[model samples]
Target: MSNIVKAKIIEKIQGFYEAVDDNNNKFTVKLRGTLKKTNDKLNCVIGDIVQIDVEDNVIIGIEKRNNLLLRPLISNVDYVAFVCSIKDPDFDIINLYKNLLWVDRENINTILILNKIDLVDDKELEDILKLLSQKLKHIKVIAISIKKNIGIDKLKEYIENKNIVLSGVSGVGKSILVNKLLDIEELEVGEISKKTKKGKNTTINTRYLEKNKIKIYDTPGYSAVAIPDYTDKKEIMTWFPEFKNYLSLCKFRDCLHIKEPSCIIKFKVSEGEIDKDRYEFYKTLVENKGI
Candidate 1:
């Protein structure tokens, strides 16, 4: 008799995943391909609760998810932190905006972390902070230097009660942050290549630390990607918290908050009410999404 087995995906390897059954008994396994065909939308990502056949050995079907991320392709994730570094890789504000948009479109709770604060001078820090505050108004931002062990307590506090995923580009200290979160010795920190100045991928799988009631899913960093078409942001403008109050005030009801007559958003951007960097971010998004 095939049992309807429900399991929470913990870690995924090349073609196998380590899942926990209802009783917290763990098993290593793979999904049946029929599941992929049936759930047209299912891809069996990390953090997903799936119903397996458990007949012989296979994940037969993945139930619908409460939350999912496309770029890293993680599912049922409760929180996403867009970790940024103030120096070294230098802050790529544009990519940061795109990451924020990904979370916002998915309706997932998100936060921002400005890592490597110890590397920047006060002026640089203020400039970065001011830009983020003015532009990404709806999101929360925390500053830290994980290598120096600064602000990590606050980062841990923010993610205390959730199944969280840390995602961003390489060499921005995602894995370093993971080490801090897990407090593991000889903590698998990979060095960035001196020649390329890029991160040596340390974590190849989604690993977790189960204490403190916090399960942190450290995902492989992803290259910067434009927002996925896999979602419907019909009112894309409104998806941005900072854009909401001024959305209605846009000249065209269909206003993308871009290039319109009597556009309040443009006015704010010009008046310095909106951060110019964020305005440019919207422009880039509209261009990339071809909205």
Candidate 2:
């Protein structure tokens, strides 16, 4: 008789998957030929729980995922740590907001990590924090410095025993932070380009690592984040939590908040109740049909 057991996919390379069972027994499994033939759009990815045939070392079935992210192509993510550096590559609020929109659409829990705080002075850091607080009050922000070993413990506490993915543009210190968290210098750290002041791509593949029972998926840094195609332009407003209260107060029942008469959202922007930059960014996303 053939035995089958449940396992979680930790990594995928070439055509094989590295999975670990409940007992921590590791197996290098391949997709069953029948499974491949049937499902044309196979969605198998890291963090997906699957059933494997022990005898054949083949993935037989994939369990239903709670959530999935397309960019890193991971399933069942509990938290996404969007890392941004204050210097080196420089902080780009627009990019951060764009990533947050993607995460909000997926209904995933997100934490904004401002890395490289050591490079910025106290007043500059305070002002940035203030700006973020006003614009992104719904999300939690943690400022960390890898060089000075600041806020690492606090960050670890927030993600303890949870499945997390470190995502950011290349050169934002995601790999370096991972090394610190895992207490090993395993992943390569890339340097920022002196001319462009942008991070060079370092992590090319997503890999899973465990530290004190904390599950982490370190993903490749993206220079440009791609929005999900499934995102409905009409529902873009729903992704912006700051617009929630004023949305219901709008004149039209289905107000897109653009050129609409007596729009509460627009009025709030004029009153300085909403961040103008954030509102403008929202308008851009909606006007472009979420492109």
Considering every candidate listed, which one attains the maximal TM-score? Answer: 2
Q: Write the per-residue lDDT of candidate 2 for residues 188-284, one digit (tens) a residue.
A: 3333334224433356688888868667888876777665564556688887888877778987988898899999999999998888989998898
C-alpha lDDT of residue 32 in model 2: 82
Global Cα RMSD, each model: 4.1, 3.8
lDDT of each: 0.74, 0.83
* Residue-level lDDT tens digits of model 1 in 1-291: 547678888877877888887576787878787656554434777788877767656887777889777767788877888777898888887677667777887788877888999998889899989877777777788999887788889878878878888776777877667766776553434333442244334566667656665677777666656665635434566546666677777667777766668889899888987778777767766666442
Write down the TM-score for model 1. Answer: 0.78
Candidate 2: regions farther than 4 A off: 32-42, 186-201, 230-232, 245-249, 271-273, 289-291
Q: List the residue pairs that clash in candidate 2.
A: none
lDDT of 2: 0.83
How do the predictions measure up, each by TM-score? Answer: 0.78, 0.85
Candidate 1 Cα lDDT to native: 0.74
Candidate 1, run of 10 with poorest lDDT: 187-196
